[model samples]
Target: MSLSGTRTHLVQTARLNTFVREAGDPSAPVLVLVHGNVSSSVFFDALIEELSDTYRMIAPDYRGYGGSERKTIDATRGMADFSDDVVALLDALEITEPVDLLGWSAGGNIVLQVAIDHPGRVRKLILEAGGSPYGFGGTHGQDGTPTAADFAGTGGGTANPDFCARLAAGDRGEEATSPLTTLRAVYVKQGFTFDPEVEQRYLDGMLATSVGDDIYPGDSVPSDNWPGSGPGTTGTNNGLSPKYLNQRAFADLDPAPPVLWIRGEDDVIVSDTSLFDLAQLGKLGAIPDYPGEDVAPTQPMVSQLRAVLEAAGEVTEIVYADCGHSPHLEHPERFVADVRAFVQ
Candidate 1:
């Protein structure tokens, strides 16, 4: 659905049909927003509306999410598939000039891949509670060392089955494991609540996730590691595995684009002790078969990101207190001010 000053439509790129939400004047400087996993471009609706006067905002729902064509994500390619899709969309729109890019969560990794592969395409880069350069889970340290040779405990298999089931069933109830509850508990910090209408919109976006073996959680392989499973070669979760998605090369760029890294101080999802990390869970006794800290430790996501950005060159880091994984949602006024300062 279109929001005030915004329009939703489908754009057929060379790779697939993509759903796009756009706002602001066509002649304005372009600012592309890429949403994270389990969510579509709809998450950016408020931001688009907030900044419509200054930017030609473009938010596209990548494959396997929102109204985009459902396609199996090739985990072996890392984030190349998604990054290429973004570039293809830009090409389809005849946007030849470099544009400002903002990526949230998984979308952050995709944008980094884009900058690494096609540096000239991005005028500046913004990562909001982005994933580690080394991928999401099954890794440790600021360097992102794999926990196992097979990269166990970090793939489609790691996904909570009940959560996926609920997602597939489109369960909109307030059950503990339901999408709404997860969004409420995990998406943001504790005690934070969305406006009722906005909450429903975001919930609808979350439910749009395509579910299948080659989709949402993807597939996995047997392993002798502590988790007893490894990343499979298909689906979104596997595609995000450290085994496949590693953008360490981003630091090697001769002259990387300026970057603005914004994250919440209390972000549980991407924090060093991320609750989602099986290793962290194991340490906290939430998962059985503790492998000890030496064998498995919480991934130092923020430090790793800082290291890469520092090495890459010009970088600005902003941490918001009393916030969670989504600074944009929690502090829209501040978020917009930061963006305006950085991009202007």
Candidate 2:
């Protein structure tokens, strides 16, 4: 497909106005793409362009992201705010038939929730470096047991203030923690270089992230655990805390849709030993007063998902070697080919 003619629109859903991008024929079988935390639909534009000829690609920005109406994301709902909003977008667009769903990072979790909650509306499911079924943090063991009832090692407090500040300021520096650096170093394959022309648009999408206790990082509680912080009641990050989110129940879905779990083999954000995880960093002595593994062992996020999907018995996983968190960007051709074949 030619890399041109992408259209953007704002649709009035029941909850709020959602900003969406569309490519390809409207009547083609839809492939709904959802992006992760701190990003918007724009991140999937490339993937959409590549697959547009085969599918009607629709990517929507969640509330408080991109050009969507900014609103408080209720963490207590466990991504229900995002899932419901997606459902509303589909309804508003009059998409009654089940659609193929693809999501990356936190968005992956949202699509899973949709499949679990509304099986009739999802034809196939794809999770691209999705968060753990146990949620983002504060868990141990393959079963994803919470280290503390409060999920004391996870939540908004886990975010680096300097990094958040830089994002808010739209800092384009190549420093270790700058948004651009993070994108280059962590979001893609180690040696991959992003196109300079498209980098600023991605940065703009990242900076559009809403910050606060009720938003991106959410709130936190004091913890006896290492680093001394736990998940609090609200925010997009907190919503993924083990305190409120779990996708193990996904195995219970009847007549479950086939799932494709595609990820970069080098992903640090959602790996068995994630560099972004507090427990992993704590064990590495990066955080002071580090508690040994007994108290808060690193959560095997990939192992957890595999177990859940194995139990469900309809998952196909693809690991792209030499790739990072965003396989679509790191290995777009393979990613698109995998998605196309899997959906077919």
For each of the candidates, give the backbone clash count. Answer: 0, 1
Candidate 2 per-residue C-alpha lDDT over 79-188 given as tens digits, one digit per residue, 9 for 90 to 100: 88899999999999999999999989999899989987778899899999988888987887878888877687787888988888898787888898898888887878
Q: Tell me which residue pairs clash in candidate 2.
A: 152-230
Total colliding residue pairs, candidate 1: 0
Off by over 4 Å in 1: none
The best candidate in terms of lDDT: 1
Task: Name the 10 consecutive residues with the lowest summed lDDT in model 2.
Answer: 1-10
lDDT of each: 0.92, 0.87
Which pairs clash (backbone N, Cα, C closer than 3 Å) in model 1? none
- Model 2 segments beyond 4 Å from truth? 1-3
Cand. 2 Cα-lDDT: 0.87
Alpha-carbon shift of residue 59 in model 1 (angstroms): 0.1
